[model samples]
Target: MTVVQVSAGWVPLAAALLLTVATAAAALDGVLAARAGGRPLGEGLLTPAAETARLFRQRRRTTVAADLPLQRIGGAGLLTAALLMVTVVPFGRWTVADLSVGVVWFNAMDVLLWAALWLAGWGPNSVHPLVAGHRFLAQALSYELPLMFALTTPAVAAGSLRLGDLVAAQSGLWFVVWMPVAFVVFCAGVLAFSAWGPFSAALGGGATGGVLAESAGVDRWLVTAGRYALLTAGAAFGATAFLGGGHGPLLPAWLWVLVKTALLLAVLVALRRRLPVVRPERLTVPAWLVVLPLVLVQLLVVSVVVVVRG
Candidate 1:
Protein backbone atom coordinates (compact mmCIF):
# COMPACT_ATOMS: atom_id res chain seq x y z
CA MET A 1 0.00 0.00 0.00
CA THR A 2 1.13 3.53 -0.72
CA VAL A 3 2.09 5.54 2.31
CA VAL A 4 -0.24 8.42 3.15
CA GLN A 5 1.21 11.71 4.29
CA VAL A 6 -0.51 14.85 5.43
CA SER A 7 -0.12 17.40 2.65
CA ALA A 8 1.73 20.59 3.46
CA GLY A 9 0.08 23.96 2.91
CA TRP A 10 1.52 24.30 -0.56
CA VAL A 11 0.54 20.78 -1.67
CA PRO A 12 -3.01 21.56 -2.81
CA LEU A 13 -1.85 24.70 -4.60
CA ALA A 14 0.88 22.73 -6.33
CA ALA A 15 -1.56 20.02 -7.32
CA ALA A 16 -3.87 22.63 -8.79
CA LEU A 17 -1.04 24.11 -10.82
CA LEU A 18 0.05 20.63 -11.88
CA LEU A 19 -3.49 19.96 -13.08
CA THR A 20 -3.34 23.15 -15.16
CA VAL A 21 -0.15 21.93 -16.83
CA ALA A 22 -1.70 18.54 -17.37
CA THR A 23 -4.73 20.25 -18.90
CA ALA A 24 -2.52 22.17 -21.27
CA ALA A 25 -0.60 19.06 -22.18
CA ALA A 26 -3.86 17.24 -22.84
CA ALA A 27 -4.98 20.08 -25.11
CA LEU A 28 -1.68 19.95 -27.00
CA ASP A 29 -1.96 16.20 -27.35
CA GLY A 30 -5.49 16.62 -28.68
CA VAL A 31 -4.28 19.03 -31.32
CA LEU A 32 -1.62 16.51 -32.25
CA ALA A 33 -4.16 13.73 -32.47
CA ALA A 34 -6.30 15.74 -34.88
CA ARG A 35 -3.41 16.72 -37.16
CA ALA A 36 -1.23 13.61 -36.91
CA GLY A 37 -3.52 11.31 -38.82
CA GLY A 38 -1.77 10.85 -42.19
CA ARG A 39 0.21 14.01 -41.58
CA PRO A 40 3.48 15.25 -40.04
CA LEU A 41 3.53 14.94 -36.24
CA GLY A 42 5.46 18.19 -35.73
CA GLU A 43 2.57 20.24 -37.07
CA GLY A 44 0.18 18.55 -34.69
CA LEU A 45 2.43 19.15 -31.65
CA LEU A 46 2.71 22.89 -32.29
CA THR A 47 -0.96 23.60 -33.04
CA PRO A 48 -2.01 24.21 -29.46
CA ALA A 49 0.84 26.62 -28.87
CA ALA A 50 -0.04 28.51 -32.02
CA GLU A 51 -3.69 28.63 -31.08
CA THR A 52 -2.89 29.81 -27.56
CA ALA A 53 -0.76 32.67 -28.83
CA ARG A 54 -3.44 33.65 -31.28
CA LEU A 55 -6.10 33.65 -28.59
CA PHE A 56 -3.84 35.60 -26.26
CA ARG A 57 -3.29 38.28 -28.89
CA GLN A 58 -6.97 38.58 -29.75
CA ARG A 59 -8.97 41.46 -28.30
CA ARG A 60 -11.95 41.13 -25.94
CA ARG A 61 -15.27 41.92 -27.50
CA THR A 62 -18.09 43.89 -25.93
CA THR A 63 -21.52 42.31 -25.96
CA VAL A 64 -24.39 44.75 -25.82
CA ALA A 65 -26.52 44.31 -22.65
CA ALA A 66 -24.66 41.11 -21.72
CA ASP A 67 -24.49 40.08 -18.10
CA LEU A 68 -20.76 40.60 -17.58
CA PRO A 69 -20.66 39.04 -14.13
CA LEU A 70 -22.36 35.86 -15.26
CA GLN A 71 -20.26 35.75 -18.43
CA ARG A 72 -17.02 35.96 -16.46
CA ILE A 73 -18.21 33.44 -13.92
CA GLY A 74 -19.27 31.02 -16.61
CA GLY A 75 -15.96 31.29 -18.43
CA ALA A 76 -13.89 30.89 -15.27
CA GLY A 77 -16.22 28.31 -13.71
CA LEU A 78 -15.03 25.65 -16.15
CA LEU A 79 -11.53 25.81 -14.66
CA THR A 80 -12.96 26.26 -11.20
CA ALA A 81 -15.03 23.08 -11.46
CA ALA A 82 -12.07 21.19 -12.86
CA LEU A 83 -9.77 22.33 -10.05
CA LEU A 84 -12.37 21.51 -7.42
CA MET A 85 -12.79 17.96 -8.74
CA VAL A 86 -9.06 17.26 -8.33
CA THR A 87 -8.92 18.21 -4.66
CA VAL A 88 -9.41 14.58 -3.65
CA VAL A 89 -7.46 13.06 -6.53
CA PRO A 90 -4.23 11.62 -5.14
CA PHE A 91 -0.91 12.20 -6.83
CA GLY A 92 1.39 9.43 -5.66
CA ARG A 93 0.20 9.26 -2.04
CA TRP A 94 -0.86 12.90 -1.75
CA THR A 95 -4.26 14.48 -2.24
CA VAL A 96 -5.37 18.05 -1.66
CA ALA A 97 -8.39 17.52 0.54
CA ASP A 98 -8.47 13.71 0.85
CA LEU A 99 -12.01 13.87 2.16
CA SER A 100 -13.67 10.74 3.58
CA VAL A 101 -16.35 11.29 0.96
CA GLY A 102 -14.03 11.83 -1.98
CA VAL A 103 -16.32 10.07 -4.42
CA VAL A 104 -19.17 12.39 -3.47
CA TRP A 105 -16.80 15.31 -3.62
CA PHE A 106 -15.93 14.40 -7.20
CA ASN A 107 -19.59 13.96 -8.02
CA ALA A 108 -20.46 17.32 -6.52
CA MET A 109 -17.87 19.11 -8.58
CA ASP A 110 -19.04 17.33 -11.74
CA VAL A 111 -22.59 18.37 -10.96
CA LEU A 112 -21.40 21.96 -10.99
CA LEU A 113 -20.66 21.69 -14.71
CA TRP A 114 -24.37 21.95 -15.44
CA ALA A 115 -24.48 25.38 -13.89
CA ALA A 116 -21.17 26.49 -15.34
CA LEU A 117 -21.97 25.63 -18.94
CA TRP A 118 -25.53 26.84 -18.70
CA LEU A 119 -24.53 30.16 -17.24
CA ALA A 120 -21.86 30.49 -19.90
CA GLY A 121 -24.19 29.71 -22.73
CA TRP A 122 -26.87 31.98 -21.33
CA GLY A 123 -24.54 34.82 -20.46
CA PRO A 124 -23.91 35.60 -24.07
CA ASN A 125 -27.63 36.23 -24.68
CA SER A 126 -27.22 34.77 -28.17
CA VAL A 127 -29.57 32.22 -29.67
CA HIS A 128 -26.84 29.71 -30.45
CA PRO A 129 -25.18 29.83 -27.02
CA LEU A 130 -28.60 29.65 -25.35
CA VAL A 131 -29.32 26.55 -27.40
CA ALA A 132 -25.95 25.16 -26.41
CA GLY A 133 -26.67 25.69 -22.74
CA HIS A 134 -30.03 23.94 -23.05
CA ARG A 135 -28.40 21.10 -24.94
CA PHE A 136 -25.89 20.56 -22.13
CA LEU A 137 -28.70 20.30 -19.60
CA ALA A 138 -30.43 17.72 -21.79
CA GLN A 139 -27.14 15.89 -22.22
CA ALA A 140 -26.56 15.89 -18.47
CA LEU A 141 -29.84 14.03 -17.88
CA SER A 142 -28.61 11.30 -20.20
CA TYR A 143 -25.18 10.77 -18.63
CA GLU A 144 -25.27 11.90 -14.99
CA LEU A 145 -27.26 8.99 -13.53
CA PRO A 146 -25.22 6.36 -15.33
CA LEU A 147 -22.08 8.16 -14.28
CA MET A 148 -23.22 8.07 -10.67
CA PHE A 149 -23.93 4.34 -10.93
CA ALA A 150 -20.56 3.73 -12.55
CA LEU A 151 -18.80 5.55 -9.73
CA THR A 152 -20.85 3.62 -7.19
CA THR A 153 -19.35 0.33 -8.29
CA PRO A 154 -15.89 1.29 -7.06
CA ALA A 155 -17.16 2.80 -3.84
CA VAL A 156 -19.23 -0.31 -3.21
CA ALA A 157 -16.22 -2.55 -3.80
CA ALA A 158 -14.02 -0.47 -1.54
CA GLY A 159 -16.85 -0.04 0.94
CA SER A 160 -15.81 3.57 1.38
CA LEU A 161 -15.97 6.90 -0.39
CA ARG A 162 -12.39 7.80 0.45
CA LEU A 163 -10.29 7.89 -2.73
CA GLY A 164 -7.13 6.72 -0.99
CA ASP A 165 -9.00 3.77 0.44
CA LEU A 166 -10.36 2.97 -2.99
CA VAL A 167 -6.84 2.96 -4.42
CA ALA A 168 -5.73 0.71 -1.62
CA ALA A 169 -8.58 -1.72 -2.30
CA GLN A 170 -7.37 -2.03 -5.88
CA SER A 171 -3.92 -3.23 -4.88
CA GLY A 172 -4.96 -6.79 -5.64
CA LEU A 173 -6.88 -6.02 -8.85
CA TRP A 174 -7.69 -2.91 -10.82
CA PHE A 175 -11.40 -2.03 -10.81
CA VAL A 176 -11.39 -1.51 -14.60
CA VAL A 177 -10.69 -5.19 -15.20
CA TRP A 178 -13.61 -6.27 -13.06
CA MET A 179 -16.10 -3.58 -14.02
CA PRO A 180 -15.46 -2.90 -17.70
CA VAL A 181 -18.98 -1.61 -18.37
CA ALA A 182 -18.80 0.80 -15.46
CA PHE A 183 -15.40 1.98 -16.65
CA VAL A 184 -16.70 2.54 -20.16
CA VAL A 185 -19.74 4.35 -18.87
CA PHE A 186 -17.61 6.46 -16.55
CA CYS A 187 -15.31 7.38 -19.44
CA ALA A 188 -18.32 8.33 -21.51
CA GLY A 189 -19.52 10.48 -18.63
CA VAL A 190 -16.11 12.11 -18.53
CA LEU A 191 -16.50 13.08 -22.16
CA ALA A 192 -20.04 14.25 -21.55
CA PHE A 193 -19.09 16.44 -18.61
CA SER A 194 -16.09 17.90 -20.38
CA ALA A 195 -18.04 18.35 -23.65
CA TRP A 196 -15.33 16.38 -25.36
CA GLY A 197 -15.45 14.20 -28.51
CA PRO A 198 -18.74 12.44 -29.18
CA PHE A 199 -20.38 14.14 -26.21
CA SER A 200 -19.52 17.70 -27.32
CA ALA A 201 -23.08 18.68 -28.15
CA ALA A 202 -22.72 21.96 -26.28
CA LEU A 203 -20.34 23.31 -28.89
CA GLY A 204 -21.73 21.37 -31.83
CA GLY A 205 -20.79 22.28 -35.39
CA GLY A 206 -24.42 22.12 -36.36
CA ALA A 207 -25.06 25.44 -34.65
CA THR A 208 -21.86 26.97 -36.01
CA GLY A 209 -19.95 26.40 -32.77
CA GLY A 210 -23.03 26.42 -30.52
CA VAL A 211 -22.03 27.84 -27.10
CA LEU A 212 -18.92 29.26 -28.69
CA ALA A 213 -20.72 30.90 -31.61
CA GLU A 214 -20.79 34.43 -30.23
CA SER A 215 -17.67 34.19 -28.08
CA ALA A 216 -14.47 35.71 -29.35
CA GLY A 217 -10.96 36.70 -28.15
CA VAL A 218 -10.30 35.99 -24.47
CA ASP A 219 -13.84 34.88 -23.79
CA ARG A 220 -13.49 32.07 -26.28
CA TRP A 221 -10.02 31.29 -25.00
CA LEU A 222 -11.14 30.79 -21.41
CA VAL A 223 -14.10 28.60 -22.42
CA THR A 224 -11.91 26.42 -24.64
CA ALA A 225 -9.16 26.09 -22.03
CA GLY A 226 -11.68 25.31 -19.31
CA ARG A 227 -13.18 22.45 -21.34
CA TYR A 228 -9.76 20.87 -21.85
CA ALA A 229 -8.94 21.35 -18.18
CA LEU A 230 -12.12 19.49 -17.24
CA LEU A 231 -11.03 16.67 -19.55
CA THR A 232 -7.63 16.48 -17.78
CA ALA A 233 -9.29 16.29 -14.38
CA GLY A 234 -11.62 13.51 -15.57
CA ALA A 235 -8.68 11.49 -16.91
CA ALA A 236 -6.83 11.86 -13.60
CA PHE A 237 -9.92 10.90 -11.62
CA GLY A 238 -10.42 7.82 -13.84
CA ALA A 239 -6.79 6.82 -13.30
CA THR A 240 -7.25 7.05 -9.56
CA ALA A 241 -10.68 5.41 -9.43
CA PHE A 242 -10.00 2.58 -11.90
CA LEU A 243 -6.31 2.13 -12.79
CA GLY A 244 -5.02 1.40 -9.27
CA GLY A 245 -3.96 5.04 -9.17
CA GLY A 246 -0.19 5.36 -8.79
CA HIS A 247 0.39 1.69 -7.92
CA GLY A 248 3.28 0.27 -9.90
CA PRO A 249 6.85 -1.05 -9.58
CA LEU A 250 10.28 0.39 -10.50
CA LEU A 251 9.30 4.03 -11.12
CA PRO A 252 7.94 6.47 -8.57
CA ALA A 253 4.19 6.41 -7.94
CA TRP A 254 3.82 10.00 -9.12
CA LEU A 255 5.18 9.07 -12.56
CA TRP A 256 2.70 6.23 -12.84
CA VAL A 257 -0.14 8.65 -12.08
CA LEU A 258 1.04 10.94 -14.85
CA VAL A 259 1.49 8.09 -17.32
CA LYS A 260 -1.93 6.61 -16.73
CA THR A 261 -3.65 10.01 -16.81
CA ALA A 262 -1.86 10.99 -20.01
CA LEU A 263 -2.85 7.73 -21.67
CA LEU A 264 -6.51 8.29 -20.81
CA LEU A 265 -6.34 11.93 -21.87
CA ALA A 266 -4.85 10.93 -25.21
CA VAL A 267 -7.59 8.42 -25.83
CA LEU A 268 -10.25 11.03 -25.03
CA VAL A 269 -8.60 13.52 -27.36
CA ALA A 270 -8.16 11.04 -30.18
CA LEU A 271 -11.81 10.11 -29.88
CA ARG A 272 -12.74 13.60 -31.09
CA ARG A 273 -11.22 12.74 -34.43
CA ARG A 274 -12.61 9.22 -34.56
CA LEU A 275 -16.30 9.76 -33.79
CA PRO A 276 -18.90 12.15 -35.09
CA VAL A 277 -20.48 14.57 -32.63
CA VAL A 278 -23.37 12.78 -30.92
CA ARG A 279 -26.61 14.72 -30.83
CA PRO A 280 -28.24 15.15 -27.45
CA GLU A 281 -31.63 14.11 -28.82
CA ARG A 282 -30.25 10.86 -30.21
CA LEU A 283 -28.44 10.04 -26.96
CA THR A 284 -31.40 10.52 -24.58
CA VAL A 285 -33.09 7.21 -25.33
CA PRO A 286 -29.92 5.12 -25.39
CA ALA A 287 -28.56 6.69 -22.23
CA TRP A 288 -31.75 5.90 -20.35
CA LEU A 289 -32.62 2.60 -21.96
CA VAL A 290 -29.24 1.03 -22.71
CA VAL A 291 -26.30 2.58 -20.75
CA LEU A 292 -28.23 3.24 -17.55
CA PRO A 293 -29.42 -0.37 -17.17
CA LEU A 294 -25.98 -1.73 -18.02
CA VAL A 295 -24.35 0.47 -15.38
CA LEU A 296 -27.07 -0.43 -12.85
CA VAL A 297 -26.38 -4.12 -13.46
CA GLN A 298 -22.69 -3.48 -13.01
CA LEU A 299 -23.47 -1.80 -9.72
CA LEU A 300 -25.71 -4.71 -8.73
CA VAL A 301 -23.05 -7.26 -9.55
CA VAL A 302 -20.51 -5.30 -7.53
CA SER A 303 -22.83 -5.00 -4.55
CA VAL A 304 -23.50 -8.74 -4.60
CA VAL A 305 -19.79 -9.59 -4.86
CA VAL A 306 -18.95 -7.31 -1.96
CA VAL A 307 -21.73 -8.94 0.12
CA VAL A 308 -20.52 -12.45 -0.73
CA ARG A 309 -16.96 -11.58 0.17
CA GLY A 310 -17.99 -9.76 3.31
Candidate 2:
Protein backbone atom coordinates (compact mmCIF):
# COMPACT_ATOMS: atom_id res chain seq x y z
CA MET A 1 0.00 0.00 0.00
CA THR A 2 2.95 2.28 0.58
CA VAL A 3 4.52 2.82 -2.83
CA VAL A 4 7.87 4.52 -3.35
CA GLN A 5 8.46 6.61 -6.42
CA VAL A 6 11.19 4.99 -8.50
CA SER A 7 13.98 7.03 -10.05
CA ALA A 8 14.04 8.06 -13.72
CA GLY A 9 16.88 5.61 -14.41
CA TRP A 10 14.47 2.77 -13.65
CA VAL A 11 12.22 3.82 -16.55
CA PRO A 12 14.04 1.60 -19.02
CA LEU A 13 13.65 -1.44 -16.80
CA ALA A 14 9.98 -0.71 -16.32
CA ALA A 15 9.53 -0.41 -20.07
CA ALA A 16 11.24 -3.75 -20.51
CA LEU A 17 8.96 -5.32 -17.91
CA LEU A 18 5.85 -3.99 -19.66
CA LEU A 19 7.07 -5.15 -23.07
CA THR A 20 7.71 -8.63 -21.65
CA VAL A 21 4.14 -8.84 -20.39
CA ALA A 22 2.86 -7.51 -23.72
CA THR A 23 4.80 -10.22 -25.55
CA ALA A 24 3.29 -12.90 -23.36
CA ALA A 25 -0.16 -11.53 -24.07
CA ALA A 26 0.62 -11.65 -27.78
CA ALA A 27 1.74 -15.29 -27.43
CA LEU A 28 -1.49 -16.14 -25.63
CA ASP A 29 -3.43 -14.60 -28.50
CA GLY A 30 -1.42 -16.67 -30.98
CA VAL A 31 -2.10 -19.79 -28.96
CA LEU A 32 -5.80 -19.04 -29.00
CA ALA A 33 -5.76 -18.52 -32.75
CA ALA A 34 -3.89 -21.81 -33.19
CA ARG A 35 -6.41 -23.62 -31.01
CA ALA A 36 -9.20 -22.31 -33.20
CA GLY A 37 -7.37 -23.44 -36.36
CA GLY A 38 -6.37 -26.84 -34.97
CA ARG A 39 -2.67 -26.04 -35.22
CA PRO A 40 0.00 -27.16 -32.77
CA LEU A 41 0.28 -24.95 -29.71
CA GLY A 42 4.03 -24.55 -30.25
CA GLU A 43 3.44 -22.79 -33.54
CA GLY A 44 1.02 -20.49 -31.79
CA LEU A 45 3.63 -19.73 -29.15
CA LEU A 46 6.07 -18.79 -31.90
CA THR A 47 3.61 -16.52 -33.65
CA PRO A 48 4.88 -13.29 -32.11
CA ALA A 49 8.52 -13.95 -33.01
CA ALA A 50 7.65 -15.20 -36.45
CA GLU A 51 5.40 -12.27 -37.21
CA THR A 52 7.99 -9.81 -35.99
CA ALA A 53 10.63 -11.34 -38.26
CA ARG A 54 8.28 -11.44 -41.21
CA LEU A 55 7.31 -7.82 -40.88
CA PHE A 56 10.88 -6.68 -40.41
CA ARG A 57 11.94 -8.55 -43.52
CA GLN A 58 9.08 -7.30 -45.64
CA ARG A 59 9.56 -4.16 -47.71
CA ARG A 60 7.62 -0.98 -47.12
CA ARG A 61 4.51 -0.43 -49.17
CA THR A 62 4.22 3.09 -50.48
CA THR A 63 1.13 4.94 -51.58
CA VAL A 64 0.63 7.99 -53.77
CA ALA A 65 0.70 11.26 -51.83
CA ALA A 66 1.30 9.41 -48.58
CA ASP A 67 2.17 11.59 -45.58
CA LEU A 68 4.95 9.26 -44.57
CA PRO A 69 5.97 11.36 -41.60
CA LEU A 70 2.49 11.47 -40.12
CA GLN A 71 1.87 7.79 -40.93
CA ARG A 72 5.02 6.72 -39.13
CA ILE A 73 4.26 8.93 -36.13
CA GLY A 74 0.77 7.50 -35.85
CA GLY A 75 2.14 3.97 -36.07
CA ALA A 76 4.45 4.75 -33.16
CA GLY A 77 1.86 6.58 -31.05
CA LEU A 78 0.06 3.59 -29.54
CA LEU A 79 3.27 2.31 -27.95
CA THR A 80 4.04 5.81 -26.81
CA ALA A 81 0.65 6.09 -25.17
CA ALA A 82 1.09 2.71 -23.50
CA LEU A 83 4.48 3.64 -22.14
CA LEU A 84 3.12 6.91 -20.78
CA MET A 85 0.19 5.14 -19.09
CA VAL A 86 2.51 2.72 -17.28
CA THR A 87 4.74 5.44 -15.82
CA VAL A 88 2.20 6.12 -13.08
CA VAL A 89 1.39 2.49 -12.44
CA PRO A 90 3.09 1.31 -9.25
CA PHE A 91 4.88 -1.94 -9.77
CA GLY A 92 4.70 -3.60 -6.35
CA ARG A 93 6.23 -0.74 -4.31
CA TRP A 94 7.88 1.47 -6.93
CA THR A 95 6.62 3.74 -9.70
CA VAL A 96 8.29 6.09 -12.17
CA ALA A 97 6.04 9.15 -11.89
CA ASP A 98 3.63 9.42 -8.99
CA LEU A 99 1.64 12.42 -10.18
CA SER A 100 -0.98 13.86 -7.88
CA VAL A 101 -3.40 13.41 -10.78
CA GLY A 102 -2.29 10.00 -11.98
CA VAL A 103 -5.79 9.03 -12.99
CA VAL A 104 -6.18 12.22 -15.00
CA TRP A 105 -2.78 11.57 -16.54
CA PHE A 106 -4.05 8.16 -17.62
CA ASN A 107 -7.20 9.62 -19.14
CA ALA A 108 -5.15 12.18 -21.05
CA MET A 109 -2.93 9.41 -22.44
CA ASP A 110 -5.90 7.34 -23.57
CA VAL A 111 -7.37 10.35 -25.32
CA LEU A 112 -4.09 10.61 -27.21
CA LEU A 113 -4.86 7.21 -28.74
CA TRP A 114 -7.81 8.72 -30.59
CA ALA A 115 -5.51 11.07 -32.41
CA ALA A 116 -2.91 8.35 -32.89
CA LEU A 117 -5.42 6.06 -34.55
CA TRP A 118 -6.86 8.82 -36.68
CA LEU A 119 -3.45 9.95 -37.85
CA ALA A 120 -2.66 6.36 -38.74
CA GLY A 121 -5.68 6.23 -41.00
CA TRP A 122 -5.10 9.67 -42.47
CA GLY A 123 -1.42 9.04 -43.16
CA PRO A 124 -2.05 6.35 -45.74
CA ASN A 125 -4.14 8.78 -47.85
CA SER A 126 -6.36 5.96 -49.03
CA VAL A 127 -10.15 5.75 -48.98
CA HIS A 128 -10.34 2.68 -46.78
CA PRO A 129 -7.94 3.96 -44.17
CA LEU A 130 -9.77 7.27 -44.22
CA VAL A 131 -13.06 5.50 -43.54
CA ALA A 132 -11.40 3.44 -40.83
CA GLY A 133 -10.06 6.58 -39.22
CA HIS A 134 -13.46 8.24 -39.24
CA ARG A 135 -15.22 5.22 -37.80
CA PHE A 136 -12.74 5.03 -34.94
CA LEU A 137 -13.37 8.69 -34.09
CA ALA A 138 -17.10 8.12 -34.12
CA GLN A 139 -16.75 5.06 -31.92
CA ALA A 140 -14.40 6.92 -29.59
CA LEU A 141 -16.86 9.75 -29.11
CA SER A 142 -19.49 7.32 -27.83
CA TYR A 143 -17.35 5.55 -25.26
CA GLU A 144 -14.94 8.26 -24.04
CA LEU A 145 -17.36 9.99 -21.65
CA PRO A 146 -18.37 6.70 -20.11
CA LEU A 147 -14.72 5.77 -19.89
CA MET A 148 -13.98 9.08 -18.15
CA PHE A 149 -16.68 8.42 -15.57
CA ALA A 150 -15.44 4.87 -15.07
CA LEU A 151 -11.93 6.11 -14.35
CA THR A 152 -13.26 8.96 -12.17
CA THR A 153 -15.51 6.81 -9.97
CA PRO A 154 -12.51 5.15 -8.34
CA ALA A 155 -10.84 8.53 -7.83
CA VAL A 156 -14.06 9.92 -6.44
CA ALA A 157 -14.33 6.98 -4.04
CA ALA A 158 -10.76 7.28 -2.85
CA GLY A 159 -10.94 11.12 -2.79
CA SER A 160 -7.50 11.44 -4.30
CA LEU A 161 -6.10 11.71 -7.81
CA ARG A 162 -2.97 9.79 -6.90
CA LEU A 163 -2.88 6.11 -7.89
CA GLY A 164 -0.91 5.29 -4.75
CA ASP A 165 -3.78 6.62 -2.68
CA LEU A 166 -6.25 4.64 -4.76
CA VAL A 167 -4.34 1.42 -4.05
CA ALA A 168 -3.98 2.22 -0.36
CA ALA A 169 -7.72 2.90 -0.10
CA GLN A 170 -8.40 -0.59 -1.42
CA SER A 171 -6.57 -2.22 1.48
CA GLY A 172 -9.91 -3.34 2.82
CA LEU A 173 -11.92 -3.89 -0.41
CA TRP A 174 -11.19 -3.40 -4.12
CA PHE A 175 -13.22 -0.79 -5.98
CA VAL A 176 -14.31 -3.59 -8.31
CA VAL A 177 -15.99 -5.43 -5.45
CA TRP A 178 -18.54 -2.65 -4.93
CA MET A 179 -18.26 -0.76 -8.24
CA PRO A 180 -19.03 -3.52 -10.70
CA VAL A 181 -20.48 -1.17 -13.27
CA ALA A 182 -17.39 1.06 -13.24
CA PHE A 183 -15.15 -2.00 -13.54
CA VAL A 184 -17.17 -3.35 -16.47
CA VAL A 185 -17.26 0.06 -18.14
CA PHE A 186 -13.55 0.55 -17.56
CA CYS A 187 -12.83 -2.81 -19.16
CA ALA A 188 -14.97 -1.88 -22.14
CA GLY A 189 -13.08 1.37 -22.53
CA VAL A 190 -9.82 -0.60 -22.52
CA LEU A 191 -11.06 -2.83 -25.32
CA ALA A 192 -12.31 0.14 -27.30
CA PHE A 193 -9.10 2.13 -26.92
CA SER A 194 -6.99 -0.86 -27.87
CA ALA A 195 -9.23 -1.62 -30.83
CA TRP A 196 -9.20 -5.25 -29.70
CA GLY A 197 -11.42 -8.03 -31.03
CA PRO A 198 -15.06 -6.91 -31.05
CA PHE A 199 -14.13 -3.24 -31.08
CA SER A 200 -11.94 -3.78 -34.15
CA ALA A 201 -14.26 -2.28 -36.72
CA ALA A 202 -11.79 0.50 -37.35
CA LEU A 203 -9.30 -2.10 -38.55
CA GLY A 204 -11.60 -4.28 -40.66
CA GLY A 205 -14.95 -2.55 -40.52
CA GLY A 206 -14.75 -0.20 -43.48
CA ALA A 207 -12.50 -2.15 -45.81
CA THR A 208 -9.99 -4.95 -45.96
CA GLY A 209 -7.41 -4.22 -43.24
CA GLY A 210 -9.04 -0.79 -42.66
CA VAL A 211 -6.36 1.56 -41.29
CA LEU A 212 -3.88 -1.19 -41.99
CA ALA A 213 -4.85 -1.42 -45.64
CA GLU A 214 -1.58 -0.14 -47.05
CA SER A 215 0.85 -0.64 -44.19
CA ALA A 216 3.93 -2.80 -44.66
CA GLY A 217 7.20 -3.83 -43.06
CA VAL A 218 8.02 -2.03 -39.80
CA ASP A 219 5.12 0.33 -40.23
CA ARG A 220 2.73 -2.60 -40.02
CA TRP A 221 4.68 -4.13 -37.18
CA LEU A 222 4.51 -1.02 -34.95
CA VAL A 223 0.76 -0.65 -35.26
CA THR A 224 0.09 -4.35 -34.66
CA ALA A 225 2.55 -4.69 -31.76
CA GLY A 226 1.18 -1.44 -30.33
CA ARG A 227 -2.35 -2.81 -30.31
CA TYR A 228 -1.25 -5.58 -27.99
CA ALA A 229 0.86 -3.20 -25.95
CA LEU A 230 -2.13 -0.95 -25.40
CA LEU A 231 -4.06 -3.97 -24.23
CA THR A 232 -1.23 -4.83 -21.82
CA ALA A 233 -1.11 -1.29 -20.48
CA GLY A 234 -4.87 -1.19 -20.02
CA ALA A 235 -4.83 -4.51 -18.15
CA ALA A 236 -2.14 -3.27 -15.80
CA PHE A 237 -4.08 -0.08 -15.06
CA GLY A 238 -7.29 -2.06 -14.60
CA ALA A 239 -5.57 -4.30 -12.08
CA THR A 240 -4.23 -1.28 -10.27
CA ALA A 241 -7.38 0.85 -10.23
CA PHE A 242 -10.06 -1.79 -9.86
CA LEU A 243 -8.73 -5.18 -8.75
CA GLY A 244 -6.40 -3.83 -6.02
CA GLY A 245 -2.83 -3.58 -7.26
CA GLY A 246 -0.44 -6.03 -5.65
CA HIS A 247 -3.03 -7.09 -3.10
CA GLY A 248 -3.37 -10.84 -2.73
CA PRO A 249 -3.07 -13.51 -0.04
CA LEU A 250 0.35 -15.13 -0.50
CA LEU A 251 2.33 -13.62 -3.36
CA PRO A 252 4.71 -10.71 -3.04
CA ALA A 253 3.08 -7.38 -3.90
CA TRP A 254 5.02 -6.99 -7.14
CA LEU A 255 4.40 -10.59 -8.12
CA TRP A 256 0.76 -10.22 -7.25
CA VAL A 257 0.58 -7.20 -9.55
CA LEU A 258 2.06 -9.20 -12.41
CA VAL A 259 -0.20 -12.19 -11.72
CA LYS A 260 -3.37 -10.10 -11.66
CA THR A 261 -2.29 -8.14 -14.76
CA ALA A 262 -1.45 -11.34 -16.65
CA LEU A 263 -4.74 -12.98 -15.74
CA LEU A 264 -6.73 -9.96 -16.84
CA LEU A 265 -4.62 -9.62 -20.00
CA ALA A 266 -5.25 -13.27 -20.87
CA VAL A 267 -8.98 -12.94 -20.35
CA LEU A 268 -9.09 -9.81 -22.52
CA VAL A 269 -7.00 -11.43 -25.24
CA ALA A 270 -9.35 -14.41 -25.20
CA LEU A 271 -12.44 -12.20 -25.22
CA ARG A 272 -11.38 -10.94 -28.65
CA ARG A 273 -11.67 -14.43 -30.10
CA ARG A 274 -15.02 -15.33 -28.53
CA LEU A 275 -17.21 -12.21 -28.72
CA PRO A 276 -19.39 -11.22 -31.64
CA VAL A 277 -18.35 -8.10 -33.48
CA VAL A 278 -20.00 -4.80 -32.51
CA ARG A 279 -19.57 -2.43 -35.41
CA PRO A 280 -19.04 1.29 -34.85
CA GLU A 281 -22.65 1.95 -35.78
CA ARG A 282 -24.08 -0.46 -33.22
CA LEU A 283 -21.61 0.68 -30.58
CA THR A 284 -22.70 4.32 -30.53
CA VAL A 285 -26.30 3.85 -29.47
CA PRO A 286 -25.54 1.41 -26.69
CA ALA A 287 -22.43 3.20 -25.50
CA TRP A 288 -24.37 6.45 -25.03
CA LEU A 289 -27.92 5.32 -24.28
CA VAL A 290 -27.04 2.40 -22.04
CA VAL A 291 -23.42 2.21 -20.79
CA LEU A 292 -23.13 5.93 -20.07
CA PRO A 293 -26.02 6.14 -17.63
CA LEU A 294 -25.12 2.92 -15.85
CA VAL A 295 -21.60 4.13 -15.17
CA LEU A 296 -23.01 7.49 -14.04
CA VAL A 297 -25.21 5.74 -11.54
CA GLN A 298 -22.25 3.70 -10.42
CA LEU A 299 -20.34 6.92 -9.96
CA LEU A 300 -23.20 8.38 -7.93
CA VAL A 301 -23.30 5.28 -5.73
CA VAL A 302 -19.57 5.53 -5.02
CA SER A 303 -19.92 9.20 -4.21
CA VAL A 304 -22.66 8.45 -1.70
CA VAL A 305 -20.70 5.65 -0.07
CA VAL A 306 -17.56 7.75 0.29
CA VAL A 307 -19.53 10.51 2.00
CA VAL A 308 -21.17 8.15 4.52
CA ARG A 309 -17.91 6.34 5.32
CA GLY A 310 -16.15 9.64 5.85
Task: Pick the TM-score winner.
Answer: 2
Each prediction's Cα RMSD?
A: 2.0, 1.0
Across residues 65-172, which tens digit of lDDT does each residue of candidate 2 receive?
Answer: 999899889889999999999999999898999999999999999999999999999998999988898989998998899999999999999899999999998999
Q: lDDT tens string, model 1, 51-144?
A: 7788889887757787778877987888888888877888887777778999999999999989988888888888888889999999999999
- TM-score list, all predictions: 0.94, 0.98
Q: How well does candidate 1 match the true structure in TM-score terms?
A: 0.94
- Mark the regions of model 1 whose C-alpha exceeds 4 Å error after superposition: 2-8, 11-39
For the record, the alpha-carbon RMSD of candidate 1 to the native fold, in angstroms, is: 2.0
